[model samples]
Target: MTRPIAGWLSDMDGVLVHENQALPGAAEFIRALRDHGRPFLILTNNSIYTPRDLRARLSATGLDVPEDAIWTSALATAQFLTDQEPGGSAYVIGEAGLTTALDEAGYTLTAAEPDFVVLGETRTYSFEAITQAIRLIQGGARFIATNPDVTGPSADGDLPATGAVAAMITAATRREPYFVGKPNPMMIRSALNRIDAHSETTVMVGDRMDTDVVSGIEAGLRTFLVLTGSTRREDIARFPFRPSEIVDSIADLVDRVGTPA
Candidate 1:
């Protein structure tokens, strides 16, 4: 028999909403979690927006996830740094999300002899910033990235994300960055810790097999792959691991929000 799921961690983009639009059954799923009084968190690998900013964006899409109920790569990265090097300084190359997280975590942002060179998502990737990051990493600063996602979804198309830039920096400095987001399992563990939930009684819902499913498995959580996102049915066979459950979308699991698997 399967254990009853007491907590939930779900991805934001492919699982809930896509490109300013809410996917099918998304609203109902959120409501069901609320109705059951479940501890739930919406997770995203994008480190481009703060949790408050993400909440507002989801609100516009008709999903009413709270700011506290949302977790991002930015937060995970900051938390990881806090654990690794408390009160350490960093040189950042991202937008408000990454910078704000580091700042709130009591990290001083600087360009001179920083402890780490942090990379994240930005609408615009400046050549000057990358150059500085390359030089900083070469100068003995450790390289750290929010996530390993190479590309992000845009209405226009896929855009180069943190991983691509990390690769560039690695090539220039010969130092690979330690990723702190999905697929790393550290991010999953951090999210579980945040909710005070045991991985044995929690489920991870996501649209991607590589990041979401893999991380959930590594973190000892049941995994659910929703087809409403970036992954397709055929894509499953390509991965060495598999999700515990596969659903058409968030709607299919609405009734099982607080029930046994």
Candidate 2:
């Protein structure tokens, strides 16, 4: 018999919800994880909202998820900073999620000769903030971003994300910001650490092959791709690597939870 998956890490947007609406079997999947007492985390690259905010949003969509169950890029970035430079100061351009995580990590948010210029997602991108970030980088502050996603989905259309803004900053400062979110595999590793999950017995469920599957593979976890989100079956051929399994949606994974392989 194969080994059973003891812990789970799932992407937030495509796997569980799409445009604020819970995807098929998303609630059931989450419930199954909780009922079975499986360690799991809902991961997201969006750094705009805190876990508390995310829990409320998920609750609004009828998914009963606790705040701690949700992991954000902001959290991962803060953890990375804490490890790299404990209690270091940063000039930040983001919302509460980024700032709060840094604060909890004992990082001071400052603009005076900060250790880093941290960038993250926000509802509105400020030109003033961007300018300050550019100047900071030029002034020798290390450039860091939460994620590398160039665009984000909105009801209207694709909105320019952190990567896009980071590009602008890079053009001005001639320094590329190091992205610490998915595709880095550091984020996944941290999530596993948070839940005391070992890579050998954990599963990473995601929609995008580029970010989810790649990071999972790099982190030494089995990865499952769901079509209910981004990468379609046909799109899989384009990627150099493949997921361990492909399912129609999170619904298909519902019964697999806690089932001994």
RMSD of 2: 1.0
- Which whole-number lDDT from 0 to 100 does residue 26 have in model 2? 95
TM-scores for all predictions: 0.98, 0.98
| Weakest 10 consecutive residues of candidate 2 by summed lDDT | 252-261
Per-residue accuracy of model 1 over 122-178 as CA lDDT, tens digit each: 989999999999999998999999999898877898999999989999999899999
TM-score for candidate 1, residues paired by index = 0.98
Worst 10 residues of 1 by lDDT: 252-261
| lDDT by residue for model 2 (30-51), tens | 9999999999999999999999
Clashes of each: 0, 0
lDDT of 2 at 78: 97
Model 1: runs farther than 4 Å from truth?
none
Clashing pairs in 2: none
